[model samples]
Target: MSNESVRVVLVNTTHPGNIGAVARAMKNMGQSELVLVAPRSFPDEQAVWRSVGAADILENATVVETLAEAVADCHFIVGTSARGRRIPWPTLDPRACARQVLERRNSGQQVALVFGREDRGLTNEELQICNLHLHIPSHEDYTSLNLAMAVQVVCYELRMLALEGSLSSDAQSEWDAPFATAENVERYLEHLEQTLIEIGFLDPVAPRQLMTRLRRLYGRMNLDEMELNILRGILTETQKSLHKSSTAK
Candidate 1:
């Protein structure tokens, strides 16, 4: 799969100039897809000025209303977090995150590396939506980093992974199926939860962390399209069975 399948998504970005720099960083690293989610300001002169030679990335960027819309089609999503949240998440450093992303991309999966707003980073809700978390190891004394700089660091790691040719000729000999996108997995999860609720397998209100835990499990599995669809079909059939039993009763 081409690196073009990897998208760089910015969520709730506040600075127009930062968006430009992010585009530049992505372009330099051979990633071209740019998705902007609710930027405070865009299509502004400063963004164009800062994009410099990466005007194409800026020009072709897709602006969306929410993070969900931005990554709806992605198979894997790596969200960047500057700090830990109350709800723990599976975390990886920049290099490791890049490896996982490239691995998915090599198998023909659409992936997204998401960056949050400059001031607050990603909210808990936003982080929960991602498959995995990536944190840049910075000095404890001073961890504050500009949004663009963080984008550059992550992009640089991806660039290095591309240069190293991590998926060598030997790896290419194996059949790599087209995997399900993150969106597909997410949709299946929703379908599953709904089916369970319909059958009284899951409580409707205050579901606790059951779905969250299940998401973590599936994310680690890196499920392909066939696997995901099979699971969803099982849920559908189970729901149909429940309907038939109720009608007979």
Candidate 2:
């Protein structure tokens, strides 16, 4: 696993000590990159004091104003949450989430794992930006974990995945390279929605929630460039067929 492919991001962290501890945890796992989004007390003397031998991580950390800025380059994002949200989204355990991250990294994609504030966790808006939600299994009665502890657990799982080499026999082959870029996927999605609209699959007046669900489904697949092209071609052909059918009628 390329060390630079995966990054750990802490958003709105309030405690300087926690930040230092997180850096230490990441270093212990042989991971170096750390990003801070709108930290409350960054570069603080307390933080530097606590970082100890991992001070290099603190010095090299990218401090950004917004969460989006911190993760804009990342192709895959996984957010950690201890509680279920009001919205419906598929949730994965830490190990499963780590596997997903590894797969994306091995495919030469940058991935970001986001951890929210220490006090309240991620807000609804922040959670929406993430493609996957990860939760560490714990005792049912008291599951709220310290921010540093949460980071440690997640970093540990990711490190283990990296060390283990291949988690399954179905490891990605060279042929499974990304066929399309992020921009290509977005354009294809737009074209798909337009085609669906033209075919009356989506109501013009009041479109159903199909597109959002489809987006989520496709996001989970992390479609490569070739797979995306195939899907786009199918959509284009379907549109042509619809046009012919309309002309015939």
Candidate 3:
């Protein structure tokens, strides 16, 4: 199954117990990969105690210094938050989120379902790294969720989608190009930002939200090799035009 390809990423997780509980939830859902980004406390006694039989996940968990490092190789990234952002992200409720993950996983692409910190959730900059945002609908008056509880709910939806035999796909895409990895797309965004600045379309000194919003938009496009090449060619031509203008002056 593609379960092994689904990575659960915890960013800036503070509570050791919550991390352990997340491990248990992931194990229950058959997801083996767990990435912890700058967690406050891990390998704690409380976490081990809470994990019980799922301590293997905690022991095998890959800890990184940054969220980018955590999901660098993933082809699809989904982040979770309790509230909305000022510039809304492409979102899916738990059900649609599961389907998207499963589809990408089935297509042999690694996917990361990211959970944010306990108190404030993912920062706007971190959320920009994601392709999709997900929120679990809860009571309107009191919507706060414990970190582990949110993990459990998302994991449960994933497990249910698998059990229900809904993960299959009949549509065959003729394109052979693989979906661009998150790292590659990130680099592409950097190139795009630089080109835009060179073309005088984007003021480098006051970029504002231009790059972030663009990243959010193209992050979901799942650009293939041909598409990426075409985009880079356009950027190359734009740069050539800038060089020509400078030579003329």
Candidate 4:
């Protein structure tokens, strides 16, 4: 798996020093791409100082205003979450998460490993943007982990897998098309919601977990570009038919 295909993303980080340390951790694991989403502080001496010899990583990091922008081009996204939510996502331990990341990378997919803020971690809405959720499996007495520490743990697993060279590369190899990017998936979901509303199948006024559940279902499918296009075409046809029926009436 090429390290260039795997992106380490930090979202809404409060400390520049932590960002520096994360870059260091990523560098130690042979990773190069770093993305920062709405960091509270950056380009600070504290961050450069924390990076030590890894200052080059900081120099090339991409800073964005939102998580969507940080991973829009990425096809596979993994978000780090420490706590359980009302609707449990497909949670993976650090090792499993690392394996999945490498597998996707080997299969020619752009993958993003997303880390959240220092204090609160990723919001539920942010976590929902991810295709999979990763948990470090810390001890019950002290489950909370330092931001850099959490990153280091996952990065270490990735490094070990890369060094061993045991990961299978057959995943999605026979597929005719590439997987849909995160941005395209978001766009398709928006299109789906609009069609559902047009058909009176979903009530926006009392929208509960319908969209969330649909997102989960689609995320699990790992839909390819062709599959997504086919689904979108069906939605468009359905919309056109509804418009025609309304005009006739």
lDDT of 3 at 242: 85
Residues 136-237, candidate 4, lDDT per residue (tens digit)? 999989987999899888989988888765545665777899999988999999999999999999999988999999999988888899999999999999
Instruction: Kindly report which residue stretches of model 4 are placed more than 4 angstroms away from their true locations once superposed.
Output: 1-5, 166-249
Per-prediction TM-score to the true structure, in the order listed: 0.65, 0.64, 0.64, 0.65
lDDT of 3 by residue, 155-203 (tens): 8888888877654453335567876778878888999998988778899
Write the residue-wise lDDT of candidate 1 on 8-71 in tens digits: 8999888899898888877787778899999989887889888889989988999999999999
lDDT of 2 by residue, 131-239 (tens): 9998889899988788878888888888788777555544565555754677888898899899989877898678778989988887778788878878999999998
Candidate 3 all-Cα RMSD: 22.7
Clashes of each: 3, 5, 0, 0
Kindly state the number of residue pairs that clash in model 4: 0
Whole-model lDDT per candidate: 0.86, 0.85, 0.85, 0.90
| C-alpha positional error of residue 171 in candidate 3 after TM-score superposition, expressed in Å | 30
